[model samples]
Target: MRGRPAALLLAALLTTPAGAATLPSASILSGTCCPGTLWTPDSRSLLFLDGPPARASTGIYSVPAGGGAVTRRFSSVAFYSPDLRWAVRPGTGDATTLERLADGRRFTLPTRGADVVWSSSEARVAYARSDTTGNFDRRTTRVFVANVFGAPRQVATVYGGGPTAWLSEQTLLMSGKASASARDRTLFALNVQTGARTTLRSALGFRSVASSPDGKRVVYTVAFDSAARNGLWLQSTAGGAPRELNAFGSYRWRDARKLLLIPLQTDGGPHVLRQYDVGTGAWTTPGDLGDQVRQGDWNVSPDGTRLSYLSARDGNVRVLRLP
Candidate 1:
């Protein structure tokens, strides 16, 4: 589970046809490229964040499918963009701002803090505002939506500590606290236009949620034990029982047929990038990229032909391509 032997297995997988064709060798960015989140809109470009710690100094960067220069789109703290063109960078002090990459335009929006999310069309941004008094017991959090440069519109008031995902142009998928103990979290689908909401999942204890490429399915991880053992599950958007997928790792749908999963060893170390066949429910062991790199980030190219991920070798974070 540790050291050279594990690395060798990874290398063997890389030499195989399926591993090599899915991920191609590529160049690394100038600095450490730790992918915070990955987004693939097409086959040509991949967008992700490279930085240290959440809520710290970080920015968004994009690299080509073949891998070359990592373009720094914006500076300071920012969140992911829907269309990958604009990022919401909350300013210091009294006002919050949205930064547009098209023309480098920065506009002030009415928001106390930025938990910004882009509309499905990437034409608007939504965020949450919270008021916490010194008492710590009295607090209020509300969600709002606004055009990229227009005024803010109130959506709904939600409790603290939950994640949100856009299901479609008119609906939002949110994980809300369902109990006072905070042990249970419920998934809710809210319609932005009608203000109607419905529950998707309840008491699931899931930590991460990712929507499929077609927006018809969702993949998420939930802890199964107190020792931090976890499992991955897939649920349909139509709201039925979740089907558990046995592989242990964070995964993303490469297309409608395949999933890019990063396996976790029993010793709590990451193994390699594994491709899971959604149709057959089988895992293809990942190949290695020789001694200079170990493990690729589970990110597929926008076109679905190649997989690119951050590789750490010789004490550096290098961008490695597998194809």
Candidate 2:
């Protein structure tokens, strides 16, 4: 009888061994829902766009983190503000409508069908309009900013790039060539109120530029340019030498001080999660996904407690609690 109990315990251990470094169990949280899932700002639910063939009507639908009924959150879809306070509906032309969700108050900005880059407070927004008939890299781009329900005015003009982020209530991060003939792009911080510019870096090109949550630092990718500058770089928006992050892949800021990444590995193995600390300059491997992430679709939650990714093996959204 004692041997039988021991054998049962051994069998259990063989199936699920203790202290294993496997990924946290991920719950598939959707039906025939689809991909392109985004977390609600509260991080309580995942939202996806769906249409008549799969859902009752075309709208934004939400699924509970724990998996339950998928319900429509909005009857009509638009570029929603981060806090869900406004719906930005772009017309077929230059007119884009902004409807305040609370009071149904409405306004319009000539955003030319381009979505607005909102400030951290969601009170101010920035956007750009580019000339259509110029060289792709040297097109004249005009940047504009406005307050909620207010008028927009041109703030700056660059050869190609547009507003990257609102570094603060009054500051904007932007990049483009100094002139149409220049070979380098200048990534700089602009004070919209004071018209002061702080040059951050000049590079052949910048990709995936993201600002830290606190608006103090920025990280970006410089690829296919030159050997001396082709890497993932981090720099202060206040202007400083860029530091190249040793590891590269898809990266997102986990918080003010840590960045989460899944290294670009194509061996058909499960994607692994790694983290880097800006304060200590150390990297740590937390765990693996145990499944491939489809289309690089993964994001660390705003609260940094969880992560969500689309499963390559199942074509379903999966959620995992992060360590």
Top candidate (TM-score): 2
Q: Which pairs of residues have clashing backbones in candidate 2?
A: none
lDDT values of the candidates?
0.60, 0.83
How many residue pairs clash in all the candidates, one count each?
Answer: 19, 0
Task: Kindly report which residue stretches of model 1 are placed more than 4 angstroms away from their true locations once superposed.
Answer: 1-24, 30-82, 103-107, 131-140, 179-183, 224-230, 266-270, 279-282, 286-298, 315-323
Candidate 1 lDDT tens digits, 50-157:
655532456766666555766755565466465657766566764776777779887887566656776668876667766656322223456777776788788776
Task: Write model 2 residue lDDT over 1-323, tens digit each, in one string.
Answer: 22356556334322322233667755656453668788888888888889888877899989887678889999888889878888999997899998989899998999889869989888899999999897968898999999988999898989878888888999999999878898999999999998899999888899999888888999999877876787788898898789887556788888889888787765676777888888888877788888878888887777888888888888778898888
Per-model C-alpha RMSD? 7.2, 9.6
Clashes of 1: 19
TM-score for predicted model 1 compared with the true structure: 0.71
